[model samples]
Target: MRKLLVELGGTRAVAEMHDDIVPKTCDAVWRVLPVEGMAIHANWSSREIMLHLHGEKILRLPPEGPVRRGTTAPGDIVYFWRSPQMSRGKQLAYSSEFQRELSELAIFYGDPAGGGLAADDPARSGRDSNLQVSTLFATLIDIPREFARKCEDVRHTGLQRLLVTRLGQ
Candidate 1:
């Protein structure tokens, strides 16, 4: 997987390698300090929240509403990735490892009563551990990076339709 360092509103974060052919979601966990001064701008979607840093919505969701009533602790940092999968005709999916972690967190919080826990992953049975909060930009939205290969100038213009037509040569 190729790693790319991205700058959001002057803040630096890393982007992990992802599928270039098919649209996919990705998130990066970074270390957060006591006063990192990071700003988060989020937009609510039908099923999840889209997080933005600077002007780009990189992370998908985390503690947006009922989904994380008590799952988050004092210093745990997480980023979400939502994509359109064929399983449910367009559903959100997450990494298996991350899903497991979220499941355990929900159970640790006593499994609060609400629609929030229903959408979360199944809890993992094992030792509960504390994780460090790493501040970084996660790609909650999927991208067709391979499309860039078909073009002479491989710069994104914020328009998927245009990219799709000009890409994949």
Candidate 2:
């Protein structure tokens, strides 16, 4: 059985797929939508928003409601980036460094899709921001814990290769 750990609003939850699984007060069981690239999973009953991190399905309070795709509902929901603040002190879980890396990746590459980095010049382009985000998300959200750590190592090396190629002697 594969289990992933997730941090939601400072609370911890473990997402696992198996029979007779235990649910924590802040945790819920969910069937991850593999096609969405490890995004949020819609609540089975309430249509609330929940994120799949490290195999753990985390549901923050005050559910974000259903996600509608045009007229058809996709049966998933998440807090819009533009939505009002979530809690009195709670901030979105994004980091400035991460965003900076993502922006660089978007401009230099194209977008952060497919979770891999492709450069016109192996010696010029390095770990773009989008790739970092993709790697982070792919590692932290999709894979199991042990594999996730390996992914992090891969991410580090990939970025270093880019950096060295770009600024080497």
Candidate 3:
């Protein structure tokens, strides 16, 4: 029943951890309280904002952690275990094969179902298999009507500041 307060731009949102369903994942996130990062628009997922924890190390997902599949609804918080990107030696070029290696905290602000991706639709595979393997940790709760609107504004305006912290902390 842990609660997280997420501040995006000037709007405030709340998320309730799914400890019952994803206990391990919730513990991992809880240990890293007050995760401050920049909210960037996701490239692979639609209507989702990815929290980029710059220079911060994150706990690795458990080997047998619970994995949630399919499209996420508005207010769903997903964790992406991004692999480290590799650079081509001596070529001074970055390879797309290993691009976007930082772990991401994704916050969905729109309904995936409305976007033609059903919750149980098997055809909704992500851009890569890695995305499909991301974990669902929590869901936003008691969100204000303006929360999604502000997220949309931030998505279009540029990267915005986001703070994820526990209720008492």
Highest lDDT scorer: 3
Candidate 2 runs further than 4 Å off: 1-18, 23-29, 35-58, 61-150, 154-169
**Candidate 1 segments whose C-alpha is farther than 4 A from its true place:** 1-50, 53-71, 86-115, 118-169
Per-model TM-score, in order, reads 0.20, 0.19, 0.75
Candidate 2: residue 125 lDDT (0-100): 30
Candidate 3's displacement at residue 14, Å, is: 0.9
Please list all clashing residue pairs in model 3, or write none if there are none.
Answer: none
* lDDT by residue for model 3 (1-169), tens: 8989999888898899988887988888898878886677654466787775544446567423544556467888877664553212442222232235556588888855123342334543544444333677888986577888777776578768888899855
Which TM-score value belongs to model 2?
0.19
Where does candidate 2 clash, by residue pair?
Answer: 4-54, 15-55, 15-56, 101-129, 102-129, 105-129
lDDT of 3 at 145: 72
lDDT of 1 by residue, 1-169 (tens): 4343432232233334333421232222221111111222111111121122221222333322123323333112234332222123221332222222221111001112123432232431113212211122223122233322211121222211110001111
